[model samples]
Target: MPDQVLELAGVAVLVCDPAGPPVTTTQDALDLIGAAFLGAEVVAVPASRLNEDFFSLGTGFAGEVMQKFVNYRLRLAVLGDISRHLAASSALRALVHESNRAGHVWFLPDLDALEARLTTPT
Candidate 1:
């Protein structure tokens, strides 16, 4: 299925298909960012769609991809449970903790949580 736009809490979010291509490189992230430009204020990517390198902070892949979203003023919501990845890396856990506190990037457990965040005033 192609990416679909959702209007949640008065925000336009491009929800990427979990079965779609993996986001492995910075360029791939850029492609999503560009796509979101059409009518989305945020881009929701499934945790399964992210590359392994993204969870490994040493590779800086997560930072690179997230920075692109930040630079473009487009929020990124990573959906699905990533407890396994969080269990393996303390750095990633810390990153997620911090990112969740901000408005730029979010690592949500599911779409319901994303909607809650969207509905709540930041």
Candidate 2:
């Protein structure tokens, strides 16, 4: 599926397709600046499209990517069901919880949840 930009409420969001190449590195995160600059305040990337290391809390892959997004002042939502990975690691669950609370990095269950976040009055 081709990637596209969407408007959730008044928020401009860019939803990346899971079918494309995985964004696994810090450089990949920086590469997304093009979309952000184009008025994408939020980016929704599927969990399946992320590198496995992102789920391995010890690897710090998620943190690196999140940092890049945060530096750009753009929000990131990791969408789709990641139950298996979460079931395997309590640390990941805790990390996700903390990240969600931060409001910049989110691990959402689906696109609808991402839409909610974008639409919810903040």
Candidate 3:
């Protein structure tokens, strides 16, 4: 019954609170995803507050964590609009693009869109 894990459209998702800085360390991200994956096939990371030190997952942090996701074949979903981040460094934009293209991650605007994607056949 924890908010962390829920079933929607026959897919399991692990939702993490995005109230503060994004998890910057790979260990933290891994721990979070590992815990969530216990009951879900996907992980949802909310974007409540952008991290000051690093964008999402900190600078150069996403790649490392992403590798783990690839290894585990886990899907990651970042819920929120990224209009403000569009102006960020080109590297960040590239990373976001790569993540999306990999089909293992997403940066959606809202829960509805996220749910839609989750339900849609891949």
Scored by lDDT, the top model is 1
The TM-scores, one per candidate, come to 0.98, 0.92, 0.78
Model 3 stretches with alpha carbons more than 4 Å out: 20-22, 49-58
Candidate 1 per-residue C-alpha lDDT over 1-122 given as tens digits, one digit per residue, 9 for 90 to 100: 79999998889999999999999999999999989989999999999999999999999899999999999999999999899999999989999999999999999988789999999877
lDDT, each prediction: 0.94, 0.84, 0.69
What TM-score would you give candidate 1 relative to the actual structure?
A: 0.98
lDDT of 2 by residue, 93-118 (tens): 99888887777889898888888777
Clashing pairs in 3: none
**Candidate 3 C-alpha lDDT tens digits along 82-111:** 767757667678877776665787777766
Better of 1 and 3 by TM-score: 1
Model 2: residues with Cα > 4 Å off, grouped in runs: none
Clashing pairs in 1: none
* Candidate 2 lDDT score at position 47: 86
Q: Which pairs of residues collide in candidate 2?
A: none
